[model samples]
Structure formats: structure tokens, C-alpha cells
Target: MTDAPALFLGQSDQPETLLLSRANRHGVVAGATGTGKTVTLQIMAQGFSEAGVPVFCADVKGDLSGICMPGSPNEKLLARAQEMGLALTPKAAPTVFWDLYGQKGHPIHTTVSEVGPVLLARMLNLNEVQEGVLSVVFHVADKEGLLLLDLDDLRSMLAYVGENAERIGREVGNVAPTSIAAIQRSILQLEQQGGAAFFGEPALRLEDMLRTSLDGRGQVNVLDATRLMNSPRLYAAFLLWLLSELFEQLPEVGDPDRPRLVFFFDEAHLLFTDAPDALREKVEQVVRLIRSKGVGVYFVTQNPADIPDSVLAQLGNRIQHALRAYTPSEQKGLKAASQSFRPNPAFDTAEAIQGLGVGEALVSTLDEKGAPRVVGRTKIRPPDSRLGPATDAERAQIMAASPVRGLYDTPVDRESAEEVLAARRGEADQAAADAKLAEARARADAAAAKEAEKAAAAREKEQVRLDREAERARAPARRSNRQTPVEALTKSVLRTAGSTLTRELLRGVLGGLKRR
Candidate 1:
């Protein structure tokens, strides 16, 4: 039994330890500031690494980097170890450092698609309508086969959806322009808050985080969160995305002898603050179900009530440090925290919760049968590594030795939704110009045809007038010939008439005398 590995927490009436097999069931470390919560986390991380389980934790105060360096023997540490009857060793764990800003450690990034629209809307603090619009934008990008790799891709997709809202709304339901505008404003705000550095190609993979050292000890990955904590929403959203990614990618392993990886979330309150009911439910579900995938999640927060009850119920291990009961609300919280633990007969639970010293905590862990053991008042052991932040020179040496240094150091900008939409716009613009040119040529051809028809009509009219003048000139010659013929005939007729008249006169003189 002595050979079986266990995490040495501290002493109750006797020495107490946390079984490594049940670590995947999850746990919580709650305390007020200056209550030694960081030390408890460091000791646990060291234990998990020695058990050959990888550990991932956020470093909010920059102190956690010290875990990568060996500890110095101090009087207080030696006295505590002697009092607790522990053979304490001072040694450093194998560690890999990560930073979102790329200044303190290896840069970690995830594509916008992997972030998805639901978590992104939360990160941007979008309203319901804006969230719906963002979802529609993602839908459009997916349907069009556009890859959303970064912030620029998302922004371009938003613009494209807004410009074609009316057309797209017909097929994919209503997309309001006002909603699109609001989402755009939110994205711009996120960009200004260093969101651009978070979303891009060569995203982080879960395998990289689960690596073991050459000596068979697990690597402790410390995420530098000093700058990231400034943007609380971004920090929360990123952690949530990482959890969901692990849940989705890892296969079911049931309960193993030890977890494949252990994740510790610091400043855990931001994960639930202002989160919608749907998001909260999803988080709870992930916490409940991720255990089967051989991953344990530990939440480090200032208050016990910060975690939702559904999630808190899944935590099998509880290490609660001191809580200040100065105000009425704090006293009530103190009472609630006291009632949660399985009672210890040695002391009052409520009084112990408020009176626990800096390194003391009310600890309860799962037994071999998966039941909560009796609570014990424990003095947490100091970490085997340094208890403060690592120097810049030390951090630089660690990053230089990392195998993934070259993989994520240089950012890649592959073809994505932004480029695809720009090409589409270019093609559409060219098609419009071609149509306009064809319309103009048609108008010019019609005008030219009308002018030619008018010219042909005028030439035909001139020909008719010239023919009439020629006919008039020929009419005179015809008239002269006819007149000569008519005059000869008339003269002949007059001479015949004169001769007949002479005869008639002779006869008519005698007839006239008779008639008179």
C-alpha cells in the first residue's frame, strides 16, 4: 500500500492523502485572498505530474511560473514538514509555458470556427438579436464553404451577410440589418481588446498539452494569464472553448487508474458571470460528462457560491481555505460552505471555516468506494518547487527548449472566408459592369438604325421630285407637236367649210329671198 502513489495534502488527526484514481471526478479549491489557495494548487500540480498525469493551469498573478524551478529550503517550510512528519523533497517538475500574448511563453491560438458562434457571442457581450445574427453569419460561411480562420474572416463574413441580408433572409429566415450592425460593433470592440491575437491558424491541439517528460513525469503547462485577466470575457470564453474541445475530441475511457490530464481554472467566477442560461447549462453538462474522457477539472475561486450548484455537486474533492465572515452575506456564505462538508467530530465546521489559518483548510476527498470521507482540518504542505514567479531568463530557457516552439511561433494566414467573399464581390462587380456596357451598346445601335432609316426616306423623296420636274419638261415638247397637228387640221377644216359656205350661200340667197 505504501508503494501506491497518492497526493500528500497534510495531516488531520493523522496524515491525509488524495487517491489518484478518483482525480477525474473533479474538485474545487475555494478561499479568500492570502489564504494559501495558490500553494495548495502548486502542491496538487506537483503530485499529479509525479503520478504521470499532465497538468494545465492558468497563472493569474505570474507566481505559478515558479513551479518550473527548484525550491529553496526555508525555516518555515522545514518546520512545517517536521511537524507534519513528511519527508519533503525540494525539486522542480517538468513544465511547458504558454501565453496568449506571446511575450512570456509559447503563443496559443484557436481558429474562430473552433470558437464557434455561441461562445463568441458571449465574449462580445452581444444581445439575443445580435447573437442570432452572428449565428446566421456562421451558417452563411459554412454553406458557402468559406473557412473562418481569424477575426478578419469573421468581419468580412459579417459585412457580406449585412450587404446581402434581404437576399439571404429569403432562404435562411429573417436577418435584421440593425442586428448585423450591432454585431459588427461588438466585433470591433473585441478586436481592440487583443482578440485579434487569439483567433488564427496553427491552432492549439490537445495532444500537445498531454505530453510527458523524457523521465516519464507529466509536463505541467502554465498559461500566463496576467494580461488575459484584464479581458475577463475573453479569458472565460477561451477556457470554455478549450474544455468543449477536449470533450468533443477525446474518446470515452471510463474511469482509469489516473486521469490523462488535469485542468485547473483560476478566476473561475468569470465563467458564469452574465452567462445566459443556455451557456451555463452547457458548462454544467461538460463538467459532468468530461470525467469519462479521463480528464479532471479543478476550479479555483474566491467563493464557494461562485460555482453553480449543479457543477459543485460533481466535485468529489473539496479543499476550502479561510473565509471572512465580516458581513451578513459573508457569514451566510460561511455557513453554506460549512454545511457542504461531511462533518468532523474534532471541531465545529462553521468555526473552522472562518478560523482556518493561511496554510490550513477543511479537506475532504473520495474514498476507494467513491464516497466522501470525513472532513479533516489540514495544514497544506509547501510545493517542492519555488513559491514565486520565475525570472525572465528562466522562462526564456524553457520556451527555447520546447518542441512546439517553431510550430506556433510563426502565424499563418491561409485562404479563408474573407478572401473568398472578396473574390465573389469582384466577380459580381465585373458582371454588373459588363451588363451596363451591353445596355449602352444596344442603345447606340438603335439610334444609328433610326438615323439610317431617315436618310433613306429623304433620298427617295428627292428622287420623286426630280422625276416630276423631268415629266414637266417633257410635257412642253408633247404639247408643241400636238398643237401643230391640230392647227393644220383646223385650217383644212376652214377651207372646206368656206367652199361649202360659197355653195350654200348661192343656194341660201335664193332660199333666203323666198323665206323673207
Candidate 2:
């Protein structure tokens, strides 16, 4: 077997922390402040990176920058190195930077819709009723094939479904208007906390995070979450989305010699605090099942009590750092942390937890035979990477070179809910406007025809009046004077013309009525 401390974990004396190639299915790292917890995490991450297993870790503090460059060789560092028995060689490992805020690292992004309602409800710390309503909105979106690609899309969709709850319920089934309304209101509150940025395209692909360089070094994916940690809801929601995505997307690989992706979750307490029972159960289930997919999840926290019993039990490999017990609660937390490990006869674990020096941890891990190793206090190896932040120019250069820059740098609005909904609304408005115009035109035509008919009747009346006056004048003249041939012809012509005019006017009136 190889004597490399990176692969074999702790030595035979400290067999408890000695993890075999196969036993690192998944695990947790817990300790208090000033403990070597962060360093322990660094060691594991670097080890996994060396093993050609892609490692992803969240950098809560600014100090994890050391992982980006090799540590400087100093006498104090060399002394600590000898105590750990690691070769005094400083070296750097492959690393990639990621961030939620565009300022820190490569912008790590995801759409709110991809996160879905199940996980969002958990993140928002929604009540049961609120969650139920959120589910209805999601159901409406899903039934209609509305892609919830970002937060805005979801917000717009929720507003739509809420406003038309009855209609949606009839068409798609069970969209409670009350629930919809509540969800809409909750969404606004969520938006206030920078939820808009979290939900949109330019989303990170799962493949990009799990990658290896051409030189055979595993890529160390670092999440720059200095600001995101402030919002526990978003952070927790994102973690769940990430975990579930891996579980669902990745195929089962059974037990592999090494993990395909090693995920490091910092500030692990936020994940379980006040988490809904349903959400907690789901998380527990994913943790148990994800190991077979060649994924290793390592949680980083100051206190072991921060993790739930159910989750704590699934962590096969463990690294225990020192804890300072200043308060009653802290003392209780420390005692519980020590009890999590297998009892070792070498020293009192409870006493040792308080006495361990920097870079030294009470370690325990799985042996080559897949058994628990004896817990022992051992010095940790120093990382080859620089323990300082990278320059802006260097960071910018690295991001520029990343293959994922062009891939996820652009946003895709797509033909999702926004487009489909807008089209439907546009069509309805156009139809309404067309109907109004048709009605207005019909009224205008009716009024114009009535005026024409009135004019025609009036003209016919005037013609009859003029003919009566002429006949009266002729009768008087014919009666008073001698009979004349011209007068007689005039009377006969007038009679014939009167009958034709009367008939023709009546027919025109009938035709006008029919047309109307």
C-alpha cells in the first residue's frame, strides 16, 4: 500500500481517521472556532483533487484563497509539516473560482424556476399552507409546460395563476385562488432579497462543475459565497437544488474507488435549522442515495451538533477539530461532538478536543477493510497553494480562460411562460378591439342609410306638391277659355307621369328596406 498521507488518511496508531479508498462514500467535518476544521477541509479537498476526483467547496471566509496557490515555505510551516510527516514540498493544485455576486469569482448562477417550488418553499421557510399554495402555482406552470427558467418568470406566472385561479383550476385542476394569492405575496417578499438575480439564464451547468484539466489534475471548484451566506434562505435553497440535481441527473455508479464529484458545504447549520419535516426527510433520503452515484458530500461546521442525528449517521468518514467550550451550550455541543466518534483508548476524546493545537485534529475515518479507524490527534499537512487572495488581474485572467465563460455567460429567455402568456394576452386584446370596431362601423352605416331614405321621401313629396299646383292652374284656364290641343296633351301627359313616379318611388322604398 502507498505511504502517501493524502490517500490513506491517518496512520495505524490513529486508525480511526484512516479512510480506505472505498469507505469515503460521504461524510461530515465538524468543530468549533480556532479549531483546525477549515484546514482539515482543505486537506480533504486537495486529496480528492489529487485523486482525480473533481472537488467543489464553498469559500465562506476569504482565507480559502490559499487553495488557489501553493503555500510559502517557512520554518514554522516546515516544523508543522514534520509533525504531520508530510514531505516539506510546497505545491499548488488546479482550482476554479465561482461566485453568486458577479464581483468575486466566475458568476455562479441558477434560475429560480429550475429550483422549482418544492425546494423554494423550504428555502423561503414557508408554512404548510404557503407551501401548498406554492405547489398549486408550480402545478399550473408545469401542466401548461411553462418553463420556470428564472425568478421573474415565476413571479409573472404566479401573478397570472393567482388572478385566474378558477379558470386555471377548471382547465388544469385544483389551483386554489387563495393559495395562489398567498404565493404571489410571498414571491414579492422573496424578490426583495435579491431573488431576481438568482433566477435567470446563464445558469451553471452540472457538467461544468464536474470537470478535469488536460494535465490529469482534478479541478477544484470554489464557490465565493461571502455575501450569500448572509441570506440563509437562498443559501439553503441553492444547496438543496444542487444536491437534488446531482442525485436526479447522475446515473447510479454503485461503489467506485473514488468519487466523481466531491462537494464541500460550508456553514452546514443553515441547511437543517428550522427545516420542514418533509424537506428534512427528502434531504436525508438524497444523502443516503447520492453516494452510489460516485459523489461525496462533506459538510463543514464548527459544532457537530449543528448537523442532525439522521444526517450525522450517514457521514462514514469524519474529521473532528478542536472546540472551545466557553458557555454551557457550547460545552454541551463539544461533548456531543466527541461522542459521535468511536471510543478510542489512546486518550480521553472530550479532554483532547479542547487541548488540540492548530493544524492538529482528532481524526477518524474508514479503514481499507471498510472498518472504523481508532480516533487520534494528528497534525494536518500544509497545502501547496498560497494562503492569500488572488489579484484581480489573475482572477480575471482565470475566468477569461474558463471554458464555461462562453457557455453560461449568455442568458436565454426562451419561449417559456413569458412569451406564451404575452402572446395569449395580445391575442385577447386584439380580438376585443376588433369586436368594438365592428360594432362602431355597423352603427355608422345604419345612421347613414336612415338619412338617405328620409331625403328620398322628402323629394317625392315635393314633386307631388308641384304637380298639384300645375293641375289646379290648368283646370281653371281650361274651364275659363276655349279648348286647345296643347292643353289637352299636357293634361294627359301629367296623368301618365304621376302614376309612373308613384310606382317607381314605392319600389325604391321597398328595395331600401330590404337592403337594410
Candidate 3:
């Protein structure tokens, strides 16, 4: 096998033997902060890009933007590449930038309704009841044709349904009020943490993510997520959603010579914080199964323990950076990271990590013919791409030139949960108003009936009085100067069995005109 220009974290003595063609196999990169983790990630992405395989990686510190431009020729960079026997090519790989915020890169968006309940429940850390209620929200959204675009839509729908829980719950099987409230609370928390910004229409397309430039160079897609690292929960939820989407959307291509795209998940530990056992198992399952689809997942973290052992096992190519063993736990972590690799006989693998300099790491990758290359104290090569972030102008230019630039730029509302729940609220308000109107009508009818009875009794009493008066005075005393309108109304209401306020209220409700 020929020694092709290497694009990886560390140098290799065997050069061509390690093929890493097993699309079934993946890789991992472990290193402490500032220990050149980003640079190492860049190397792998560059390597895969050169291999004509597009790479997907998160730009946690905003540095992966450098892939958009070729790296400058520095004295140190040239020396290192020369030392590694790599004829330095002053050329950058084709690349694209993506962001959930739509700020630094093209917007990568997805709808909450599409995410569904199972994954979302895991996201919110919802209990069984809360999960069930969440499902109800999804069901309602689907039945009503409401798209759960963003967090607000789902949050509003949850509240709207909760307001009419007694009625809607009864109709929709068993939607517990308690669970709805709990899910609502979780939604609020997610909103406050900025999860609302992720969902909407014109969602990210997996096909777009897997595309290359017209020049046939795989586009290295970089995500700008500097602010997201602060919100661990949101970060984890978003990452999991991305992976699940890839699995669900991408076709089963079986094993190709190389992965169509590779995903480098930085800050991998956040992915498991408070995750339920079942969801964690599901993640492991996705990681294991996605390889057959020709997608490689590389997790970058500070320690091996950050990854679940089940997930740790699926990583085939391993790149370990230097770790500080000042504390007992740190020392233990170093040993574990070292033991994870199939040892290279040339160097003491355990000590190599502490002794490794910045821009250097211990690499173990598949050989050219697709075998595990002999581990060596390999010198890492400088990236042919920029060592740092692309300039603002560069990002803007690339974004403008991006095929997906205008695709997700404008957010779409699409008659989703927000619209559905808004309509439902309008219905409820109308229903309440109608009920009030009916009640008023009933009172007016009753008042008219009572008025009829009172008028008859008064007429009868007058006849009796007149008859007696006629007997005494040979003529009935004529009743003149009839009672005033106010007095007449009071006298009529007093003859009824109802209270005065009720009669007055009824009169007001009937607008002083009882139906005859």
C-alpha cells in the first residue's frame, strides 16, 4: 500500500496498512481542554474529506470554521508536516457551516412534532406519567394537524389542553392532568434554557448534510454552538435528536468502502446527563447500528469514562491526547484511556499520553488494506486547512454560496401546534360566552312567566276590593295616578318567589324586556 498524504490526529510508521474501510467500525478522540482536541478533530475531518467522505462535526469553540479555507504555511506547520513525511499541500478542504441558532452558519432545524414523544420525553427527563401526557400532546397535534414547530407551540398546546383537561382527557383515553402539568413544567424549563429555537419548518435535510462540493470534495459541515455548551441539557437533547434523525432518515446503504459522512460529537459527556436507562440503551443501539449505513460516529471528550462502556466499545479508530494525572481519578482515567487501545509495541502506550506535546497524540487507526495498523509514537501532521476559525467574511461568503443557504433561512410556521391550540382556545372562549348567553335567556323566560302570574293576581285582588268598596259607597273608588315605572317594576318583582337581586339581575340580563 502507498503512503498517501495522511489526514489524521497522529503520525503513522506503517503508513498504508491501516485501511479503516470497515464502515461498521467507528472512532473516538479523548483529550483535555486546550490539549489540541479541536485540532485533532480537524485532522480526522480533513482525512475523511480527502478520502471523498464528507464529515459532520460540532464546532463547540467556534474553531472548526477553519475548514472553509486552506491552512497558511507557518514555519512550525511546514516543519511538522515535513517531519511526518507529508508533502504539505497548501490547500483547504471543502466545507460548510451549520448552526441550530442560524447565526454563524446555515440553520439546521427540526420540528418538535417530528421529533415525537419518545425522544422528547427522554429530553425533558419526564417520568412515565409525564411521558404519557407528552404523547397525548403529540397525538392531539397530529389529530388536529398542528405542527409542533418550536418549544412555544408545544408549550402553548400543553397549556391549552391542560385548561380543558377534564373534557379532552376524558375523550382521549387517559391523559392524566398531573402528567400534563408535569410535562408542561418541563416544557417551560426547556424554553427557559433556549430549546425553543431548535424546532420549526424547512427542517434540516439529511441528504443535504451528506452532500459534497461541485469539485467532488466532501463538504466538511461545521456547527457553531459556542453558546450551547453552557446549556448542557439543551445540548444533549439537540445532539441526540440529530443522531436519531440521521438514523431514521438515511437509507440503508450497507457497508461502503468508506462512510458517506462521519459525525464528531464534541462534549460527548453532556449526551448522557440524567438520560433514562432505556434512552441510553437506545443511543447505544443507534451508534452500533448506524455504522452499517456507512456513517461513523466519533465522540470527543476529556475521559473515556465520559462515554458509556457499551458505546465505548463501538469506536474502532482511537486517537488519545495527553491527560493530566494530578488527581487519583485523573490518573485512573489515564490508565483506562491507555488500556482501551490495542497496544503499540514501539512505545510505552501509558506514558506516551503524559509525554505527548501539544499538536501530538497517540493514534490507532485501521490500515490501508483495512487492518488495525501497528500503534506507534506517531507525529501528528498540521492541517492543510486553517488552524483556526474562518473569518466573518469567509463565513458569510460561504453561507451565501451554500446550496442550502436560503433553504432553512426563513422559518416556517405551517399550521402546527400553535395554530391548533389557538383555534381551540378561540373555541373554548366562544363556548363560555354561549353558555352565559343561554343562562341569560333562561332567566328571561322565567321572569316573563312570573310576571304573567303576578299581573293576574293583582287584577283579581282589584276586583275584590272594588266589589267591597261598591257595597260600602255604592261605587268603587277609582284608582288613579298609576305607580311610576320604577315602583311598578319593584312591586311586580316583590310578588315573585325569587330574590330581588335575582329578579334585578334577570331584568338586566333580559334588558328589562322579559319575553311575553
Task: Estimate the lDDT of model 1.
Answer: 0.90
| Rank by lDDT (best first) | 1, 3, 2
Error of 2 at 289 (Å): 0.1
Model 1 residue pairs with clashes = none
TM-score of candidate 3 to 2 decimals: 0.81
Model 2, CA-based lDDT? 0.76
Ranking by TM-score: 1, 2, 3
Task: For model 1, state the Cα shift of residue 113 in Å.
Answer: 2.1
| Predicted structure 1, TM vs. truth | 0.88
Cα lDDT tens digits for candidate 1, 1-516: 243457889887867788888899999999999999999999999999998999999999999999999999699998998898876788999999998878898889899899999999999999888888899899998998999999889989989998898899999888988887888888889888887899996899889999998888998999999999989999999999999999999999999999999999999999999899878998999999999999999999988888888888999999999999899988888888888899988899999988999999999988887888899999998779999999999999988898677888899898899898888899999999999999999999999999989999999999999999998888755434445778899999999999999998899889989988
Report how far off residue 302 is in candidate 3 (Å): 1.6
lDDT of 2 by residue, 304-395 (tens): 79888898888877787778899999999988988887878978999998987776677777766666666777666666666566676767
Question: What does each candidate score in C-alpha RMSD?
Answer: 4.2, 14.3, 19.4
TM-score of each: 0.88, 0.86, 0.81
Clash tally, candidates in order: 0, 18, 15
Model 1 stretches with alpha carbons more than 4 Å out: 1-3, 448-516
